[model samples]
Target: MTEQEELVICVPGQRLCVADKSNVAGAGTYEQQGYIYSKLAGIVKLVTDDKTRTVEVHSITEQSIVPAPGDIVTAMVTVVNQRFCKCSIKCVGDIVLTRPYRGILRKEDVRAIDKDKLEMYKCYRPGDIILARVMPMTEIHSYQLSTAENELGVVIAHSDEEIRQMMHGFGDSSEPLFESAKIIEDVVLQQMKIIVRRACEIADRRANSKKSNIINGEDLLFLLRKDKIRLQRIVKYLELKELGCSVQKLMTANDVPQNVTDPEQLDIKKKVPFQSFLEQIDNTGELLENSSSVDDVKRRRCIRADIASKSMDEVHYMKFSKARRVSFANKNRHKFSDWICADGDVTVSKQAYTILSYLAYETVAQIVDLAFLVRQDQGKMHGDAIDRQRLNYINPFTFKPRYHSKNFVMKPLTPSEITEALRRYWSPQLDMTGPFNRWSMRRPHLKLLSC
Candidate 1:
């Protein structure tokens, strides 16, 4: 093999050459499907012999090393107890390990001077980086660790208060500390994963119960309903997203005037500028033009009309009555009218009165139309002679009874029966001939007996 061929680098699973009797697979190389592939990421080497050529890959990276007895190691305390503390070994001597190894530090080995009095919590807390010596392995899983020497102790320690201070920006200003950020991020990600996994499992179960292979939104909604807080958060997020998207679309499509100089001046309760209002009208026109369907255009128009009607109603109320204006101004307070003198009489202009009357008429008309529809439905049900007793028991609005009892059957009274019952209960002749009336009457009947 030439020097140029020796310089060829190959990654894991990369094909090197065709495998044959003349070319045999060597270390770090495997032969499959008549091809020799590299199992390590390194430079490809070809060794030539008398009969065959050997293909191999020499790795460029260092091999993983583990802590041995008597080796000095640096580790972070993970769990602390009164008897012992558990740590994760990060480095051996000067070299950092690719992955951490488990180590146990007993309280007796915390310090040589006060071995008996040493407490694991005082010597090493969780998140503290410490130096220790690896002892002979007592267990196959974790290595025994000792910090008996003066030098072998906590190198860096951060208390809970210090972490809180750092999070709240009260710590050192020169450098930003984010030691706990990664841990927090990992915990949050794990929680999210658990929630999503559970939701997916529920959805899968629901789909299976319904004899379906596809899970729909209803299944997910059922899962979300079980966690109301999370569902509320999701709903709030969706609403904000929708609002942001609408704002973004408006900003992108039109050159809206920036009247307010500061963000603080942009209040929802503040009156809109004339220019902004006109610009909104123009933007709405543009939106209508860009709408994909007639339904979209009609929906937008209806929303606009609703907003206009609400504003107009507010204007009419404020103009027609000073009491309403005061109430509107002091909306946050209960009994706002008590703080100010109410008008003895409201003097409504003809135009305001006309608008209010029309609004009332429209509202009543809508109510009447709804009632007529309900009555028609009831008539059709009655005409069909299907469940007539149940129909009488049902309410018009909800189409369900106010109360239901299995023990008692309800029978609705007819108008004539109700009138007859009232007449019998309050007959004029019965009331006039009562003992109370006889006691209050004049004694003219007694005079006839004397005559």
Candidate 2:
């Protein structure tokens, strides 16, 4: 009721909506009246135009674009295929069992205890109602739907074929049904809670770290911190060793090149406490002359350039690792998507993969025959598996089947590794400076996620 809330008041004279955009061509429609909605609860986020009036609407929390692993959904059974029963989702993103959606209840994931006893017909007849959960969204953008709860069954249905047929196309079907699907909504909701609660428990058990287990900015930060520290140590240690050796070569050289011995360029004249040695040698010239020999200044070859060039491999290694962290985070959150309840044959998720771990999957996998053999020959590559191993082949956010079981995973890495990897990853590309947390992760890698 705040004054700042923009609302469309019904004009006293107009029967239908009329706005600037409406007169241009055709902006509004009677079929989509829910376009105008209250500020508090409304499913419709987009408004066609300024002329549309806003009204108080209701929304049942359920499955949405970014569903967690255990969020339950309500759906109406649509197609009964050989291995699965497709349904139309009435609820999305959250755990709303009142409004269902279209989903495919796969034959295998039909029940909680004994899946073999699940006869598709007994479980659900066409046009029957159902309750399911967001198990996993496939890369192809289909909801890997499941009705694995004791009470997650048909909630509402209309036995009369003609009435149900009319209802399908009707804008609103609040009328009482032959088999009141509304009555079963609460029951489905009850069972959905139990099932979802249990599913969360299972996810928690599978989680390795509280931070790593849940996909967010905090986990990214943790991983980056660890990686950065280790990388810094490696870089600093290498540089220190290289510098130390250069000074050592300068101190004990008989005929090193003048250019190579340039103190300004070579950094070989670092202040050393060698005055005592010089004084001792000068005072005891006879003893020093006897001790110092031609062999002492025989000009040993310098290995500074060789060592520095060899360390460049660290950059390649780190780049792949950086992408892998993004990939890993993407893989970990792969199960969480808005695409879960979408059509498989067509569009999947509305978004793209937010991680880059799977970027060079095929190319890298090709080089490593052992990896290729394991995935191609044995054929056990899956997104979940890649997430467990932190591989990069497919972007995990969108539902594209091609990236699902990307067959490459660079190993010896875990969720903690992504943090340090981001410094090298995000640092090189964009000047984004923030904790490598969930928010930071959600922040696209500018060039990587732009467009």
Best of the candidates, lDDT: 1
Quote model 2's TM-score: 0.22
Give each model's whole-structure lDDT: 0.48, 0.36
lDDT of 2 by residue, 1-451 (tens): 3325454332211233232333221211121232221212223223334664332222334222323245576677876666788878766533343433345678988877777766775566666766677674563445677776776766764233222222211111213132422222222223323322333343354464331223321211122232333222223333454566786786587755557646676755454222233343344343213232332101110121122123335543344333322311244334323212222332222111221122112112211212222333233444455442332322222211121233222222121222233233334333344354434434332222100
Residue pairs with backbone atoms closer than 3 Å in model 1 (clashes): none
RMSD of every candidate to native, in Å, equals 31.3, 25.7
lDDT of 1 at 29: 75
- Leading candidate by TM-score: 1
- Clashes per candidate (backbone, < 3 Å): 0, 43
Runs in model 2 lying further than 4 Å from the true structure: 1-67, 93-102, 158-451
Q: Which stretches in model 1 have alpha-carbon errors above 4 Å?
A: 1-60, 161-451
lDDT string for model 1 (214-242, tens) is: 32333333444433333333334334434
